[model samples]
Target: MAKAMTIPDYHPYQQAHLNKPQLQFSDIAPLIEHYQVQPWLTVTELGRSVKQQPIYQLQLGQGDKRILAWSQMHGDESTATAALFDLLNYLQAPEQAAWREQLFAEITLYIIPMLNPDGAAKHSRVNAQGIDINRDALALQSPEGQLLMAAAKQIKPHFAFNLHDQNRFHAAGPYPNPATISLLAPAYNAEREINASRRAAMQLIAHVQPWLEQQIPQHIGRYADDWSARSFGDTFAAMGISTVLVESGAYRGDDNRQMARWLNFQLYVAWLAAIASDSYQQADVALYNAIPFNRSGGMKDVLLQGLTVSIGDTTATVDLAINLALTGDRRARIDELGDLSLFSAFHQFSVQGLAFKAGQAYPLNTALSLDTEAHLALLQQGYTHFSGDKALLQASSRLPVLLNPLRPTQGSPQLWQGATFLLVNTQGKVVQAVLNGQLISVPSGVIHNPLGT
Candidate 1:
């Protein structure tokens, strides 16, 4: 099946407008306007979110072999949602009509582009009620969860695709490579027995394994099949649906997740073609089983190795791992500190013969002159933190500007503390400054804050 399958190039079908991070409903609203007029497609409101946001379902094709797929269940996971719109555009392309015609004639798709619009608005994981709709599958407490259940029973799809995005700080295996895509044939029972429906789903993933490797080598992984009773994929599998869980993980430099989005589009087309053509039956389940389980906390944003940190009067050389929080409180925290030899980061620095020190605060005398002689001088003088007039601070400096007075904990870099301090060398020279998890080179004078906040 690997040799026989052909992966579609995602460039032609890539929705240019939806190529962004944390995509809200407003971003894709204009592109979906034409679906209303398209004769082949049917768009209907599934239900409304807790905040009264309308949830939409797009029905494509008129075949008995049904496939149900949805995205943005956990709102921050917008990569698959964008790719779903791309899939819609791909189905309408005149150039691919030949294979697409067969696909449409064989399999019908009920796609819910955004399930939790209220959560999507705020780039949150849960709904407006602070409830995780995915976990609420059995409870049916969230309106979003109820709508999904209704859609499943109404469509009774032969196959279901549970689309989601996993954290970037995870490894494909023990290797340093990040898991770009995690596939799963969700287990229906507590024993995790592979039934006929699960067998087909496993084969489908196996059929696409080679193609995924061609695109993202050593980056493919398998999500743990823990038989999550409350999860939609597992529940659907228990209901005799061949449920496939495609978790869009992180690509090394693709911070916006466009790479993952493109891969999702390719997999959808290829897998659908396989299912439509019945090519997945020939695929070996061992290929799917061979995929490495995703290992969490495998990576961090920055790692400062061999740094001398002072705890009271005792100084010890250890490694510090820093990660930038993505959602609610978007601050860089010292996730782990002390002999983090097993972990890796996008940016790693060896601060040998250097001691960590808390930076002093300097009052703003005038407007913040950034990257100027005055700025460099201030850094040399050990003024890493700043507190001053609000208007002057609004100009934006590389350093973290303190609105309120500094806390006692802010003085020293502690475990799970904020990453804001100075790295001083033997001569007491401040050679580096870490602000908001970003490493700054003092000598090169390249100290710009990556997080604008």
Candidate 2:
């Protein structure tokens, strides 16, 4: 049996090349210029985007086994682009000279740093023509798509890596933890058949999983195997090339995705090392099926349970599930308001047998804008809620009160504001209060004013 391969720790090799997760083609212009001067790298302008931005391909090594990888196919997904740059930096480092030499001797790499420059600049998923390049594989409608497919056909690479970024809400299997990284071995046909090419991809993925799991236990997810001909991975697999999909996802408290970017860098280095050593050939492909599949809607940001709520004479004990909105303001929204025993949350508050009462709403003064001092004063005075005109409420204020009420829609529940809640015990004593889905200390004598009198 072949010797079991061990991935070297590449954390120390991570450089500060990328200051932020969002990268425009202009942001990497200096690095691209620097690489153009390197003797080991050959740069070529493959094509131009709809916005007339140049798309360049960097070629390295002369080995027979070719590997083609592209980043930023969806302009908004930039984690892989950062990782690829960091990988290039590592290859040129003095300490990694021997390993880099061995990798070059075994494989040639062709990398497209930013395939959709226009989308990247605007931080959008689609290109300037509003075309999703990934879905344009079969149609070959976009210039970027045409260039990618043409390059793959000309190079006839032995392997391809399709890099992307998934939604931040996805979790690993049933675990409440966010999926920091996800992998996939795309199917070659509509039936989702696995051939030798796919088997090789799976084997490689199985090899990488252990290394990733060590860094983030129960936080790695495997993408669904549904086949889409329009997708480049599936298309490449159908062309008899082994393809691996790397999707960078959310990490707890990493709003800027800096941690995910570093993880991606580590993944690329380990994968390349494995490929150079030819250890992936011995990897157990069966382990691929054992990896956890990505799951959704299993967790919430906050859960409030066992509270007795009175909604216009309808009183019932219930639970509340809240999630942060994906867009602007990141306001907490009520996902469900019933039995949420099956769900888990990062933060949980239980107030069993406590009565929920609406707090008094103090109208904001039109002449004086609400500031942190004014907001805190109201809380100290036992006023737990506030309401005002849209302009007044929209102003920057540090008040812990809901500003508006959101109604339930067909797809999502209404995210309401201004209706603060105070939970009280049977003795009419204030126990706890929630303002704008945030826990706040309630003062005495504030529990009896359920009608906001």
Top candidate by TM-score? 1
Per-residue CA lDDT of model 2 for 1-453, tens digit only, reads 111233255555555656565789988888889888998889998989999999999998777788999999999898888888878887888877787778888889999989999999998999999999999989999999999999999999989999998877677887878788889999999899888999989988888777677778988899899989899999999999999999898776566676777777776766676777777888888778877998866566667789776666677888877665544455555667789887766566787888766555667667446665555555555455555665655435443545544431212123443224566778766666655556654443232212111
Query: Which pairs clash in the backbone of model 2?
Result: 402-417, 402-418, 404-417, 406-416
Whole-model alpha-carbon lDDT for candidate 2 = 0.76
Model 1 lDDT on a 0 to 1 scale: 0.81
lDDT of 1 by residue, 1-453 (tens): 332244346677788878677988888777667787788889888889998988889998777899999999999899999999888888888876786777789989999988988898998899999999888879989999999999999999999999999988888877777788989999999999988999999999998887787778888888888978888888899999999999898776678888888888888887788888898999999999888888888877778899998778888998988877755666677888788889877677888888887777778778765544555567678876677676666434544444433331255577777677788998889988876676777756575435532
For each candidate in turn, the TM-score is 0.92, 0.84
User: All models: lDDT?
Assistant: 0.81, 0.76
